[model samples]
Target chain A: MAVNTIHREPPEQSAYRGVRRVDHSPQIFNNQPARYYLMWLLLPAVLLLAAISLYPFVWLIYMSLHEVQLAPGKSDLWAGVDNFTRLFSDKSFARGWVTLFKYSALCLSVEISLGVLVAVILNNSRLEKLFITIFLMPMMMAPVVAGFLYMFLYNGTFGWYFWLLRSLGVLDGGTILGNKSWAMAGIVATDVWQWTPLIALITLAGLKRVPQEQLEANMVDGAGPLRNFFSVALPNLYPFLLIAILLRFMDNFRFIDTILIMTGGGPANATKILPTYLFDVSFKFFELGRGAAIAFTLLLLTILLGLILTKIFEDPTRKIKTDGMD
Target chain B: MTSVTIKDVWKYYGKTMAVKELNIEVRDNEFLCLLGPSGCGKSSTLRMLAGLEFISSGEVFFGDLKVNDIPPRDRDIAMVFENYALYPHKTVFENMANPLKLQRMNKTDIKERVVWAAQMLEIEELLQRKPVELSGGQKQRTAIGRAIVREPKVFLFDEPIAHLDAKLRSHMRGELKHLQRRLETTTVYVTHDQLEGMTMADRIAVMHEGVLQQLGTPGEIYNHPVNEFVAGFVGEPPMNFLDCRIEGAGDSASLVYDNMNLALGGEQSRILETKGAAREVRLGIRPDDLTIEMGTDHGLELSAKIFVTEPLGGDMLIEADFGQDRMTIKRKIAELGQPGDACGIAVNSEKLHVFDRDTGEAFF
Candidate 1:
């Protein structure tokens, strides 16, 4: 029966004609009800967030130029660029830069290393879902509460850490928090402990996108686990690692709330990062113009760092470079 | 080239079996096709040979060596996947040379081999282009070239030409057959398309539901299917099965079904005469063996009404209602038979197939 075949009027022409013909069907264009429903659904959230969130940002930039008086019914003065100049001259602001760099370096380095290690371990685990949920618990905790909790843990005398360190001959100090050398260390530890889970989560997400077929193909090609990780896994995780570093860098820069709750800029201003210094200048000393200048400068630093990290991290040709290898 | 042998191989994922006790011998330079419908375990069997999948039980042999535990790289087999798994970022030359590079062949040797394979596949000019820049047929050719350059002991192909358009599929089928004849590397090709298996394979292994139904040359499968499944699956407008019972004695003995009496003449009459009217059987008849007529014959005379008439370019397919059941007859395209026209069919007794109704096995 090979010679006998059946043919029908090709369905393609009819389908094309049907699609081209318009029937003035109300279902096609009468979408005002859906539009009205969508507007209603999004309107409340838009109004509420705009009122409570973005309005303050606008007001903050406005108040940054003008000085507010405590006296009732008193008008403020606008001193443009004056606060910015004073902020530049302040040695504390310079120290804030040093502190910011030191804290960010410590936080990002430890978190990235630990995050990658944990993500690698968790990725192949049988209880991957369970382990991820358990590991991400620290990041879910409030950073301020976590910092205060760690502060108590690092107490000198009555705390278990001090007694334990004394027993180990590593603690002759009255308190680890009291020493300028250990103050920044304490801040870094708090930030790292709370935020490392974020890095782990993002890294794990990246690991998930790496094709299983590619890995299996490598194995069939006689590449062992170590070579696969170095050649395939790490190179594939490039964008994720970049994103993790950028996020940690920005988060570490604005990590003043936890440090404030834990050490309050510490003994001799050792842990006085930009955010804490900005808080001290603007709220504590009421140097509004200087504080606003430092805040804006910190904002600029964040944007600059974000742009650089994004450019490096989101290199679209990363896939071509890695899989491009023969 | 080396022979590849699967020795009672079984593959299971958890409790579900993917392949069950499949045993096939691929002689040196033989183009054997594992042909079946989807989920029929053809691809899994090919993958097991390629060492891309683990064998749950039984051993696979490369030449005389047991390769159950040998890795794919050491197994010296090249595979072309259905999706044409070319390294998208690399030039076609680089993709083709990867296996040779893995062997640490000299740069000149790699270049020579890539050029030779590319030229054979008529893709020499496109060697420097990436996979995304090539058409579907071009990419498939590059994938084939990549496998060819390896010069492996065996070649495994998993539905490599399935993604091409219908016209391209037929064109590439001819090219693949030519390529295989030149290379002759004991290939094991897998496909769900029966026509692919028929056209290219020296031997086709027909499978269904992880069970091997028949293994033979394409002609053997078409003329002598071992069972109903094979009979139904092998041919286009597949072999029609009509439930009928034996009647009469000696030369007068015939096959009788609802509303028709088939007169078995010649060898079929003798075959049915000895096997009395004691059992029911399925009459397997190819469409070409049945003629549409307007009158009675010394054959089965069943009146039918044409439900549809499809006039193909060279032939026609007439679907008609025989009693409560529907049957189709193939005829010349020049027939004037239209829908609702009454007609009769003459069964070609010389080509009649009597299958045991219980087991669906041929009772010739």
Candidate 2:
């Protein structure tokens, strides 16, 4: 064989490390001609989702701009932003927003504190199964039924809870559901009774997922049980707690069945949350146009809050970031 | 610093006996390694010392203080877990500072101590990073830094480096040994790797099946393993065993196996005369002691056919079929043929170890 010697220097190890900034570029389908076929295949599902969600949303916006007439064969009147503009001066419209936040706050504070306390207690208790079953009983009951049940318990005339609270000197004189100052709390109490277990359940699951090694390591690092919970367990449960709060917060806005059944926005409208007001406007008085306007604002706020929640979830500093390491 | 004494320690989870009568006295400033396979009670023993597990019976002490009922936090001991167990949410600095903060130390002092530990572990740059951002070696170092930052009376390590890769594990062995020496705190380390035990431990307690096989220094464990299990466990290539009979006594004492009758050395004959009760004993010898003599007849320690040969760069290992048992011989020279080649082997009889056939207890 003929002698042939040639040398080509090899690339340095660092030269092809594959570390470079990634810029966004669309590379979905390399086959340009087949891309249309893929899009055509995807069209049915996209249109189905649009029909269910987007069509109704567009109708709501359209209804918000017109005075929706319910009469048979009657033409609807176009009311250019009047229904929306009227909301600025409406006393009940502004109060509804304030009351909604108030109710949510009252419900969240009591639910989170009591739920976490119950979860922590039940976590190590031998009778946890029995107690969790008992606690979840309230959650399983229909919200309207739970509301009526609490209403009876809060009735000043013959209610057992009112009599007990009066005797204990905690209630003083106010009938829980009838009194103005206490009605919001009464509605909040009903919501808490029906939902606190959900928080507890979520927190319990979070507690289980908290790394046992971290707890043991903290103990070995000279933390007592209480300190270990705060130091390690609590941080691990932060994401769970956030999720629980978000669920409960949104539920507070959506589910007014218990509130409407128990309070009916009575006692000077102390518990007239936005949903209750919307319920009365859209259903009781049939002010569909005004209701649609209010509903749009409510939907906007919900979306905004959801965005805030997503931001919190994405916050790098507070995240318990054991991603691929596990 | 304190001396950790585990006296008659036994651990039981329900009916399963994890540790049985493990007695070890780790002196102040000493690095004692509990070496065993998984589920061999090494980790259980370490946990008992750290007060993480309840001892079913007996007592554990840090110096004169009985710590049987003391909780881990109150035991004044620090432990590094096998999985690193660095708090994922906290930065490396906070994780290292946690124990001192629990002590209610001043902010400046906690910062100072944590910084010192960070520097020692070479994790200063990673102090602000959370555990999730760290590589495995970095996380291991952070865990070690967290343990050392406390400067507790006794340090308990439960196979802390077993998660690291081979290169990092070897590198950490030296770093950990030096750290223990510099800190001069009593450390009880648990590891299943005998290499780690032999290389880093001041004294090693070898456990098998939840029972202490032998307790000795590296030299003693290597040169004079008290049982066949210890002899078989402590070495890299591991020791080989063959069933044989000890014939006669004193100068005439010989190991009778297969077609060969090999006379025992003077020192071995004396030890056998004093210790051997039954004539049957298991002949134990390391692969390093047996030399391969290619195409030879004289000084043949039983003829065997080469079953396989593994030629490592520096040394080659030759496995031979000696009667019923396969014997491995490691040598440096490469003047050996392929598999199935006939070879004579010479045994350095002085390096031979004899064990009881029934109980596996060493005769010497």
Candidate 3:
């Protein structure tokens, strides 16, 4: 094969030529389209959850504005703040609010105290896992099932606990749940029993995550047990304690299924909390508008409580950060 | 500053022995480094000194007082950990001031000490920052400052600079050495890196498999290692050992290899004759001492085919093969031959180390 060779004189280049060049845009999406397509598929599931969970909240706000009369497929009428006006004047609604505040105070105090005690005990022991499992058993039970379980255990004649309490001189001859004076106490006790485990569990996890090095450093610094707990352990546990308060606050308002089943709005509404009152107004008294209004109010209260806790948890270093080396 | 003495110390984990009969004395104002690989009982020994781990046997004395049963806080010792272990929630000032504050010191005194330590560590500007906001080096400085402000009798450092980058680690190593010298506190520093031990330690205690192998100054350990372990462990590019047999007779004893024979050095001649005929011996030579050439010297020369060359700035590491066996040799990268080239490697006669092949004990 002969090698072909050609030679030609080169063309002279222009000094300042402007050429319109095709901007063959870089294929920025160079990878397989399937990867991006798979990511886009997750958006719908997320949106679906937002729609199902968030839509009802919007609807509840809307319902709060209108007067709803529920009598088997009846349409609600637009009464515009009339239900809310009636709620302020109503003594039972006021009583419900008062009772809720009192109950929350009692439940929050007892649960947190009992929870921290349990956590401390668990933290300093080898039997931690065993005690934690035993303590968390009540919390793991469904609220409705837990309510029924307590109902049987607190029943007057047939209940084993009632008999045990009577024998121990902590109770009188008659049933305690039926007495109006003792009704709220029983509810508070049940809440503490069922939910204290949750606080202990959270606090225990917090305690476990506290740096071993920090503790050792403190011990090396000559901090006694009380001083270390106050200065180091307590400050570190602030975030977990904040979480426990917010959780217990939310759960206390939703104490519907348990309190409703156990007390049925109680002897003369003494133990009627916001949720139970909401249930009674809408379903029993057929005042759906007022009930939706009350529910919205409870939601607002819960949101306010959440905001307060968020503020606390959001700025652990706020005091220190603001002081700036003082 | 206080002197520490560990006498026949033993530590056990259930039935397994963690530290076996360890005995060492830290002279007042001396910096002693416990050097070993992981699971070598170095950390355990330090923790026992810190009173973090209980000694299963024997007594540990700080000054004239036996501290075997004293709690860590009452022991009046300070420690810096690998992670820098500062309180993340506390400001740098508070972190440094913590130990002093724990003693219920006056507010003014605490501030003065913390500021003093921060200034010494060149971290005065970082006092307002939290430990989380600080860099790794800054956090480590704060930790050291915390320990320094305590002014304890003894300072225990548990691989404090192991987490830093290479350049920074060297810088901090020098800082630590200078700081310890200034303080003149008896310090027990634990490290797995022999470089840190060599650079910072007044004396290094080499440990292996939960036993103290040798204790001496860094130079002594490097030049006169007691056994195969210490010899192999102390150097950067570890010493290489070759299995050989003694042959010939009388005053003309020589080491015979598969393809070569190396005449024994003058100092080794008597020991070589005592070893007798056909005795197995291991010949050790540091990489820096092995000379590479195209021709033989008075020592045995072996032909090796270069497989790879790693140029490390001034020096080059060559991995070469002698038949089926491979060995690494360090030489000046500029004068090094490329891979696949044939080169003759000669061990410096005066630097050759011989050990009993079975027992692995250096003969001369």
Q: Among these predicted structures, which one has the highest lDDT?
A: 2
- DockQ for all models: 0.15, 0.28, 0.20
How does residue B292 of candidate 2 score in lDDT?
81
In model 3, residue pairs whose N, Cα or C atoms come closer than 3 Å (at least 3 residues apart or on different chains), thus clashing, are: none
Fnat: each model in turn: 0.07, 0.46, 0.36
- Candidate 1 docking DockQ: 0.15
Q: In model 2, what lDDT does residue B335 have?
A: 82
RMSD of 2: 6.7
Clashes of each: 0, 0, 0
Best-to-worst order by DockQ is 2, 3, 1
> What Cα-based lDDT does every candidate model obtain?
0.79, 0.87, 0.83
Better of 1 and 2 by DockQ: 2
Task: For model 1, give the RMSD to the true fold.
Answer: 6.5
TM-scores of the models, in the order given: 0.83, 0.90, 0.88
Q: What CA root-mean-square deviation does each model show from the true structure?
A: 6.5, 6.7, 10.3
The regions of model 1 sitting more than 4 angstroms off are: A1-54, A67-74, A158-186, A229-246, A267-270, A315-326, B86-101, B104-135, B248-253, B263-278, B294-300
Q: Scoring model 2 with DockQ, what do you get?
A: 0.28
Candidate order by TM-score, highest to lowest? Answer: 2, 3, 1
Q: Tell me how far the alpha carbon of residue B216 in candidate 2 is from the true structure, in angstroms, after superposition.
A: 0.8
Worst 10 residues of 1 chain A by lDDT: A1-10
Scored by TM against the true chain B, the candidates give: 0.94, 0.97, 0.95
Candidate 1 second chain TM: 0.94
